[model samples]
Target: MPDDPLPTHAGPFALGTFRAGRAPFPGLVTGARVRDLSDLVPSVRALVEDWDSRLPRLTALAARTDGTWHDLPDLDVLAPIEPGQILQSGANYRKHVVDLVAAEKESLHGATPEDARADAERMMDERIRSGVPYVFLGSPRAMCGPYDDIVLPALGEQHDWELELALVIGKAGRNIAEADAYDHVAAYTVCNDLTTRDRLYRPDLKAIGTDWFTAKNADTFLPTGPFLVPAAFVGDPGDLRITLRHNGIVRQDESTKDMIFDIPRLIAYVSTTTTLRPGDLLLTGSPAGNGAHWGVFLKPGDLIEAEITGLGQQRNTVRSSQA
Candidate 1:
């Protein structure tokens, strides 16, 4: 007896279908449908509002049927969107910072010159220095759709995996205040921020810790999707659980509540420094259990799956790279 908006039929995940050619293909969410960027932004805004108002009903509908009840087409089967930009935060988790500090101490052997310089630079970056949110951009060319294979770069032996909850900006805004940060968000998606630890830790790399752009932004480094759960479906971005599995073994198990800086703070902080545009993605920092910290790196043929409560899960397989 829930009063949620019921779909006409069950499907794999509630997806937003866009008009492509003569037919509409499932692209974003279920029940709600849109065409492209022009259609998506405005519709997403309205959808979040609707979801906020009809939470009881929507929750009932989402809970009434498991996603598996419907025959979901292969997630990889959906056409892809050219996202405007992918922005991510670093050291936003207090525990992560503690771990990084410990690692630096151990690796530098009493603060090497390079380590000192890197720490100094970190203290200056807006995203890292302010004790507020720090943001970095990922190359659009690095994006891969859900279920795509993530290639393990042969150049590095210490690869790592981070499971992060990512927000898709729905509205364009500059200098947005923390009080109104949620208004700019369109939807939520799960992302695995894969990394090459050796490249990042290498002493010869000038950028070293300062250069997540290369260490984390390599090809296929950002694996996103399953479905962009419209913000309506997810009531509060900060009240959710994030879990990561490697080859069916749990690796990262934590919650967004553990974030040292929450979503609203992140949005307000980043927007004050840069214009956040529609299709721009913000990956809130990852929780503690990363593979590199645990000494277990991904190898070819390994499977990685990341999931967030309410939002769907993203799965990827590790492929051997010839390079």
Candidate 2:
């Protein structure tokens, strides 16, 4: 058992993983300095694999006043954890879904924008009643540093950003119930799910709606983790504020409360398909005001900042791909 208590300051303390150089190591960010937990837990993956047993030791290390404290700014924050698999929720936010539906209606059906939006809201309500969360597989290779540069693929002209709240699974469980889903969560992190908007659908195969593989899963596409705010620290996952800023302009500003299927539901639904294990990421979908809705898309040298309350923040710069 940890003799020391969890640290608290201006905000909730978070678990982070960083590499001063080549080797990745677990760290604890307690508002001021990042306490290196390498002596206790080597990597975030190691900690997650044995989270239940290692948490006390982690707490003990975090609580200690004496240790190798690195200035937070000096540390090179990694992706926090290299998840076993990434399970992303699609069209999970009600407002975002409605926005897409409304846009589709206006363009495809020639409905008035206002009427289209209203009708979409009605459709969303029906979905809430009869729908289950949409889940998709994401390549862990898409992961990159939170403050790293985003290399936009030239093939995909409409590069877009989706800021999401990513849940890190703690315990291994299959067929998890909605009520017990939270028990599987280890921590939370910010994930910018970059998409190639134009490549999202296969025009050749109109019947096949979305091509998630080509649209997503590019290297440096998923910007994750300035910190992994523990699930215990992030109270009421449904209430956190999610925001994204492109070139210093706020694009997506909404609450997690707008999610059509909350974390528990998403986890439960996904767990029904695959076992949720430690270090597995479950990305709750983005909020409204995506690049498509705004009639704007990412260009070279564009900067994106994404954040969720208590999860810390991520800053990504878009760069033209040489390939």
> What lDDT does each candidate get?
0.66, 0.85
lDDT of 1: 0.66
- Candidate 2 ranges with C-alpha deviation above 4 Å: 1-12
Q: For model 2, how does the per-residue alpha-carbon lDDT over 1-323 read when each residue is reduced to its tens digit?
A: 01222223224367777777787778888875888888766688888888788777766766677877887766677788888989998999998899899989999999999999999999999999988988999999999988888999878799999999999999999999989998899888899999998899999999978899999999999999877877777888889998899999999999999999998888889988898888899999999988987999999989897778877777777899883
Clashes in model 1: which pairs?
4-57, 14-29, 14-30, 15-29, 15-30, 16-28, 16-29, 127-134
The ten-residue window of minimal lDDT in model 1 covers 1-10
Q: Residue 305 lDDT in model 2?
A: 78
Query: Which ranges of candidate 1 are over 4 A from the true structure?
Result: 1-28, 31-71, 74-81, 102-130, 205-209
> What's the TM-score of every candidate structure?
0.73, 0.93
lDDT by residue (tens digit), candidate 1, 174-242: 988878888887677777888888777547756644556657877888777655666765777777888
Best TM-score among the predictions, by candidate number: 2
**Predicted structure 1: clash tally:** 8
Compared with the true structure, model 1 gives a TM-score of 0.73
